[model samples]
Target chain A: DTAVSQTPKYLVTQMGNDKSIKCEQNLGHDTMYWYKQDSKKFLKIMFSYNNKELIINETVPNRFSPKSPDKAHLNLHINSLELGDSAVYFCASSHSFGQRAYEQYFGPGTRLTVT
Target chain B: TQLLEQSPQFLSIQEGENLTVYCNSSSVFSSLQWYRQEPGEGPVLLVTVVTGGEVKKLKRLTFQFGDARKDSSLHITAAQPGDTGLYLCAGLKGSNYKLTFGKGTLLTVNP
Candidate 1:
């Protein structure tokens, strides 16, 4: 079984469509994060949820939202997707928050293409 | 400028060669992490160096953290085809506890 897994590895939709990417971790983690990797291969943090509390919210657009159903799952929903949303979205989970905590485990990544 | 900048944006070498990837930053960090990502997959954490000037080794890989905790480096010995991937370094930054990632160095090892 995968320690971290994401659904619909590839998502393709129109610019104005709405979509959601689901993520889950079996590593018994307390924190989950979403990262966006653009075509340039620059990985940036988009959102982070620690114990169901919103922790890190980068300068991401308001159209994007993260919902953590519990400690093991973090889902990202995008409204009114734009062409700029075409990037690989990654899901990661960490055992804890501090530096000494276990390293983060990343999912296979979901590539979203908005045309 | 990136909070953490990785040099040589791209690297290509022959098998059994040696290479080093660097990640630099002006701001200090509590810890630095290195990840290796393959195509169509997310990054996999290779190592994390916490103490400044600390050096850790895993197999043929060596990781070093700067004395100032603002930078780090990854060195691979006898690089193999399996060693090729996107190398990224990140530091825990800001009050947000978010990772400041470098642009990443894509490595390709030729046969």
Candidate 2:
């Protein structure tokens, strides 16, 4: 069984379009995160949630928002996506927050292409 | 902002060779972790070093944390083709739970 799974492994949409990436994990973890890897391959943390509560919010633009309805799910929704939004988005989960969390288990990344 | 910096962004080595990847940061961290990611796949945890000057060994991989808690390194011995992947270092600084990652070191082991 896959530990962490993401939907729409590949996404191609036009500029100004809206898209969403869904992530789920069955490891019974409480903390989940969203990271973006740009063309330069720099992985930046965008958001993090612990048991459906928002914890970290990086300096991401307002167009991107993350929602966690439950402990097992964290969804990313991007509105009015622009060409600059073309990058790979990843979802990750851990058992807890901070040092208490053993390690992060990542899901297959979603490659988004905005043309 | 706390950030981790990885050296030798790209590495290409022959099988049975040895290599080392370094991760440094300007800020001190309470704990540091190393992760390996394959193409088109998510990263997997390789090791985590918490104490300053701590060294951990896993099979052919050796990880060490700097005494100042501001740097770490991963040394692989007799690297095989299976060892080719992107190695990333993440740091958890004092009072901060978020992981600040480095750009990563991409290793290509040629047979």
Best by DockQ: 1
* Chain B TM, per prediction: 0.96, 0.96
Which stretch of 10 consecutive residues in model 2 chain A shows the poorest summed lDDT?
A95-104
Overall lDDT per candidate, in order of appearance: 0.91, 0.91
Off by over 4 Å in 1: A97-102, B94-96
TM-score of each: 0.96, 0.96
Q: For model 2, how does the per-residue alpha-carbon lDDT over A9-86 read when each residue is reduced to its tens digit?
A: 999999999999999999999889999988777888899998799989999999999999999999999999999999
Residue clash pairs of candidate 2: none
TM-score of candidate 1 against the unseen true structure: 0.96
* Tens-digit lDDT track of model 1 for B1-111: 678989989999999999999999899998899999999899999999989999999999999999999889999999999998999998875345577889999999999
Residue B7 error, candidate 2, Å = 1.0
Alpha carbon deviation, residue B86, candidate 2 (Å): 0.7
DockQ list for all candidates: 0.77, 0.77
Grade the docking of candidate 1: medium
